[model samples]
Target: MNAFSLRRVGLALLAPAIAVVVSVIVTTIVIAAVGSSPGDFWSAMFSNPLPRIRVNVVNQTAMIYTSAVAAAIGFRMGLFNIGLEGQYLMASFAAASFAGAAYVGGFLNVGLSLLIAIAVGAAWAGIAGILRTTRGVSEVISTIMLNAIALTLVGYLVDRYGVHEGNTVRTTKIAAGDMVKGFTPYQARDGQVWALAIIAVLVGVGFWVLLNKTRFGFDLRASGQSESAALASGVNPKRMILVSMMLSGGVAGLIWMPALFGSAGSYGTSFQFGLGFLGIAVALLGRNSPIGMLFGAVLFAYLSAQSNTLTFSTDISPSIVQITQGVAVLAVVISYEVVRRWRARLEQRVVSRELAGAMGATA
Candidate 1:
């Protein structure tokens, strides 16, 4: 990479670095005030969150990474598609219902089920997109309302047709043979490794390539950076909005797959929630870079996994993690502005140096 690219990368890392340092300092003070040995707590976490990073952490990171990428798609386009919660849940419900109701068998069944999920998620988000493009409604409002509708629908259907054994409620399990194969090598104490981990990695790579290497991605980003400039460049803002929203939701459909295919084999009342919103935080922390999001998701998963150990061993509250997360995000937001100005100065210096060199050569 050139100096500008290297500097840009540094700018990207600066905010998260500052946020981590600030969060640690604040969290330590809070722990000390709470009558806990802040030094001991920090030592325990930094020494080892686990004997080693567990498979569960890896799986959770992958899931979160997918969620972050879904949100990043919208971020890149300057559209906040807050309806990821609705899109993924509806997709999971549709996937579970279709997979259980069908008699199809094997990997083919799994593939089809996943396709159903992507389509359902995209279609749900499409509603919001259509409204935004045609009626100029704010996506934030439409998506929030859609989340309520999606949840209500899921609740009703699960109650009506979901398998209810005793008091527990879950979707009917697919055939045992149909479960996606797990990576036994990476299995933690839980012995459940999400086979879809490969899929998550692919998604990250694809996301990076799409945004950096494709024309549509360029148009989407252009519209995001400046709608007026994009319009002057002959880009259609309406189409960008619609396409980016659908793309965001389509990727979001896969967020639940790791949990569903890797563990549940079906959707249930007990399925994981709030990841969609968590993804927004991840996207912000990572500044929408796929690699950056990977590290951000892993850091989040690590902190969360470590919190359980902290709760058991220290007087400090586990809810401290929430405070840390909030503070870290706030720190990053503030630090980003500082880094932005720093980068602009660096770029100006480089331009001035190059201009001086050209003048000297001519003289």
Candidate 2:
């Protein structure tokens, strides 16, 4: 890679690391304030029936990574997808509904249902994309509004067509064969691994290729960087914008696969919350890079998993986890800006030195 590319990668890595360190520091302070020993908290966080802890880690990792990927896809195209939670809910409900309607093989049926969920999510997101492209609406506003619409629409669907006989809000449980498994290679109470977790990593790799190696990816980036320039250069900026939003929504749908297919077995009103906003934070921490996003997701997962253990072993409230997450995101944002400025100054210096050398040779 060129120096510029390497620098970008470095910044991406640095942002998440800075966030993690800041979160640790903030968490330590909170522990002290709560009259808990930070050392004990740390011990509880790390020492465990390693397999069980790993399972929780894998679950959170999968969820966060899927959400992060959804946000990153939109961020790359200069669109903010704030409807991931609703999209996830809708897709999960669709998947569960399909699974409940028919019994099939373990992997085959689940795979097909997931495919349908992705398509549904894409279509849902495409609505906002179309609005922005044809009606000149802001995607930020459109997506936010669409989130509410999706929640209401999916809630009604679950109640009317998908819910179990006795349940007031939740859909029916997906069959055993339809749940995602083998996500972490660790044994759990359910004996199921989050197959979606493995899928999330593959999706991350696919995203890397999509954003950096493909012509479509180039067009998306160009439009994000400069819409008018991309339009002048023969790119269909409107189409790209619409397509990017759909892709973002599709990724969001993946987040729900684990919840719907792996454990929850159903969709409910309470099932759709916080994930969309968390996705925005993950995207910022990842700086729109797929690999970086994976790391950020893993870190967030670790923190989240640790929080529960910490609560059990100490006087610290579970709310401390939220505080840490918020501080981490804020720290990462500020650090990213600072690092970007520094890199820009370094590039300027390099260019200035080259120009001086050229002038001296001319003289």
Best by TM-score: 1
Question: Which residue pairs does candidate 2 place in steric collision?
Answer: 182-193, 183-193, 183-194
C-alpha-based local distance difference test score of model 2: 0.78
- Flag regions of model 1 displaced more than 4 Å: 1-13, 51-53, 186-189, 346-363
Residues 150-191, model 1: lDDT tens digits: 999998889898889888777888677777757755436646
Q: How many backbone clashes are present in model 2?
A: 3
lDDT of 2 by residue, 1-363 (tens): 288778878876676577778878988998898887888877776675356666777777878888898888888888888878777777777877777676676778888888988988888898889999999999888878887887788767776776565546666666776666554365445355665667687778888899889999899889999999999999999999899999988888878677676667776654646777887887887787786677778777777777777656776676777787788889988888887888789788878988999999999
List TM-score per model, in order.
Answer: 0.90, 0.86
lDDT of 1 at 248: 90
- What local lDDT does model 2 show for residue 306? 75
lDDT of every model, 2 decimals: 0.85, 0.78
Candidate 2 has a TM-score of 0.86
lDDT of 2 at 279: 75
